[model samples]
Every structure is written in C-alpha cells, then in structure tokens.
Target: MHLIIPNWAGVPANIGALATLRSGGVSQGPYDDGNGGGGLNIGAHVEDAPQAVVLNRALLGVLLPASPLWLTQVHGHHVVDAGEVDNVPGAVEADAAIATRPGVVCAIQTADCLPVLFADVNGRVVGAAHAGWRGLQGGVLQNTVARMRASGAGPIVAWLGAAIGPGKFEVGADVLQAFTDTAQAPEAAVGASAEMTPAARMAQTQACFTPIAQRPSKYLADIYQLARIALGQAGVTQIYGGGLCTVTDINCYSYRRDRVTGRMASLIWLK
Candidate 1:
C-alpha cells in the first residue's frame, strides 16, 4: 500500500497524517488503480461494489489507530467534530471534521477536489477538509480551523493534499466570480493584523484564476493558491504539501481525467 505521508515540519510528533494514493486495495474496474492493480478506493458513495469498498477500507484501517470518521460530503462549508459524528444517526453530512481526541481519525475523500489536513503544532487537535471549488469558495477550511481553535487547538498548520492542478482545472466565469465577488474575511481570522482587507483579499483571489486565451470565458484556476490565500486569511501560515496534481499523476485518482474514477482519502489524527 502506497501512502503519501505529509512532509510537514509543523506537525507535532504525536500527530499522524497520510494521504492515500489510488494504489493498494481490492477495488476493480473504474475504481482500479490506474496501472491495472486494485485501487484503494475507500469512498462508499462512489458506486463501487460495497464489498470491495469494505475490504479497501479494512486495508486502510490496518494502519490507523481506529476506523476513520467518514462524512457524506456535500461540497459545503459545514464542519463537525469527529468524535461526535458516530453518535449521530445515519451518515453525517459535513464537508470537514475535527478531532480533539487521540485515535479519532478525521478523513476526507477526494478525486479531483482538494483534501486538506490540519493539526495543532502542539498536537492538541487534528482535522481534515474536502475542498472542492464550491467548498473552498464556501469557507470549509476556515470553518475547520475555527472549530479546532474552539476545541483548544494552538497554532494550527495545514497540509494540502493532491488535487486537480491549475494547468488542468478549467473553470468558467461563474466559478471565478464565486470567489472574486465575495469580500468577506475568513470566519477564523485569528488576529486583526493577519486579516487582509476586503480589496486585498479579492485581488489575491483574482490572481488565482488565469484567463485561458484559447478558450473564451474560461480560466485555469489554481486550487492550491486559492487554498493558501484562504488559509493565510484564517491565520494559518505554516502550510505544506501541495503541487501533486491528480489529473497528471497516475498514482492518484482524478475524476476529471476519468469520469468513473475511484476516490483517494486524506486522513489525520492525534496519536
């Protein structure tokens, strides 16, 4: 099983974090690894055989302290406590989860969408957020950071997992407008000094979308840059682990590249 361990120096020794690649599991067909091996598609909602997903998750579970708290991602900004998720009936519909207790894994599944993992530098808490374009524009990462801070976390650091790269992620004017049109400061702007003025923030956001001359009303949006701006606005400055492009990297899954593709998981927890 190949896993991308986050190379983040800000993470405390007690915290554990890893992003799963498409390789290593029992899934087949569209969920199969791009190189013809079984894939590690842990997403239960992706229409893969239920039994295969079970086995794949079981394989992943062997490396974790406990089973991951998987949420039904809605591409929204809702954040939840990972420890409280299991007590709820049915599947939780949050796009991000924070874990204050040890061994409580906060997991986010994605193919093209960004999976961001967060942790307190002091190892007090950990979190995972699924940030598709919608969720990113909707404030998912800020909400996760706010929840972690509310739970007593200190100086949080984040690691950006694999996602569609700027070169391959094409977006329309509406997608660009969704970010540029909003000037609200991040919900978790920790200090007044760290806050970017509404105009500055909008300018930073506009820079993330580059117009594609060949395609009218189209642009190449850099999800990583957008994430960095958002995290910076939220007062999280020590960020790491970006530039892995799912669409171009065969080891990772890419829904945009393959319409019927498997999903990879990015997970974090306190040991």
Candidate 2:
C-alpha cells in the first residue's frame, strides 16, 4: 500500500516512520474505492470484511521489520508498551503505543482524529498517539511522553499526522470548555494579570478554538495546535507534520467527510 514517509529531519537512521494513505490494497465496497479497486482499508473494527482487513495488513507487513502493535482506540488516554504486545495484533485496547525494543512498531489508526508520532533525538524510543478531542483534552499526549520518559527516552520530537483541519472540525460549547477548563494560563499571562481568574485562564486557551461566524456556541478547533500545546507542556519542542488535512484532502480517509470511510495508520519503530 502507498505510505507517506514522515517529513521529520535529524532523527536517527534507526527510527522508521510513515503514515498510510487510502490507496493500494485489495478491498471492495465501502472498504475499497466502491468500484472494485485497491483501497488499503486496515481497520478491522470498522465493519470492513475480515479477509480484506487481513490482506491489507499483510500488504503493510511486507514493508516493515515486524508486525505493528495495532491499538483498538476508544479515544481514551491509554498508552501501552509495544514490546509487550508483539503477538496480540489488534487486540490491545489503547489510544497510544510506545516502543523501545527494536522492530516493535507502535501504530495508531485514525480517520479524522489526529495521529501523533514521537521519537527521541537518539532514537532510543518511539511512540504513537491517537489524539481525538476527548483524548487530547484528557492528556493522551502527556501520557505518551511520560511513558517514553519512564522507559529511558530523551528529549522527544513529535510528528503530527493527517487529521481533520480546523476549518472542517466544528464542535459545540462543551468541546471548547473541555479544553479551556483544564488549561492553565501561561505563567507570563498570570504574572501580567497579577491574579488571573478562571475566566482569564479560559480566555487564554481560546487561541486554538475559533468561533464560526453567526454560529453561536459553535467553534472550529485546531487539533494540530492543541497537540502542539500538549506536547510543549510535556517539554517536547521539536514538532512537525501538521499541514495535511484528512477532511479536505481526498488522499487520506476522513470520517467527518464520509462516515463509512477507511482508516489510515501512523506508525514508528526503531531498527
């Protein structure tokens, strides 16, 4: 299947990373191009044909050192060690995966939700996170970093994969408050205000959530920016790969655009 190589630089040669596109596989109907063509549909839980999912994974396997640790994501903040799940395939229930052992690929499936890949400067460890709004607000990114650090990873570099862009990801007031209520005001802002109130802290968190014109209580949230904010909070400064939008780009799958669309995968592993 066609894979998009990550555009990150300075990462060690041992680290191999790429995100899959919705092309080059054997599937049909909603799982394929709907006209009997090669469509790489890898999500087994999305009601795709079991044999098709297996064949898609087999196609993906031909390019990797070993099988990837596929996660059954529930939009929750659960990060699992990839080394511990070498034989389980897609049986693990987690939103993120981290790997230090060689050839243990950490993989995350996404249609519109942001798939974030992480690697240390020295290539000692790598991780993949599924950052939907709920998981992002609940600290999935933070938890991934924490797991990597606890396993001896150094300063982390992150690569954001294709996701629904801010213009297409509309949300209600509750989604906005979910981020603002938990977000703390920047130290500089707090100092400037002398005593920042809850309202002020909430305001400071508005940079990533923009209100749509004439749409009251509705907002367009920038998941990419929110991911950067979360990664920065975990001391990860080197972040890349966030311009691609799944919703607008036909090359990638987007659940928002088509509810029956296939899922793409973002993966990272050390050689």
Winning model by TM-score: 1
> Candidate 1 regions off by >4 Å?
87-90, 184-197
Q: Please give, for residues 66-94, the per-residue lDDT of candidate 1 as tens digits.
A: 98888888899999998986733228998
Give the backbone clash total of model 1: 0
Enumerate residue pairs that collide in model 2. none
User: Runs in model 2 with CA error above 4 Å?
Assistant: 33-36, 185-201
**Candidate 1 whole-model C-alpha lDDT, 0 to 1:** 0.87
TM-score of each: 0.94, 0.92
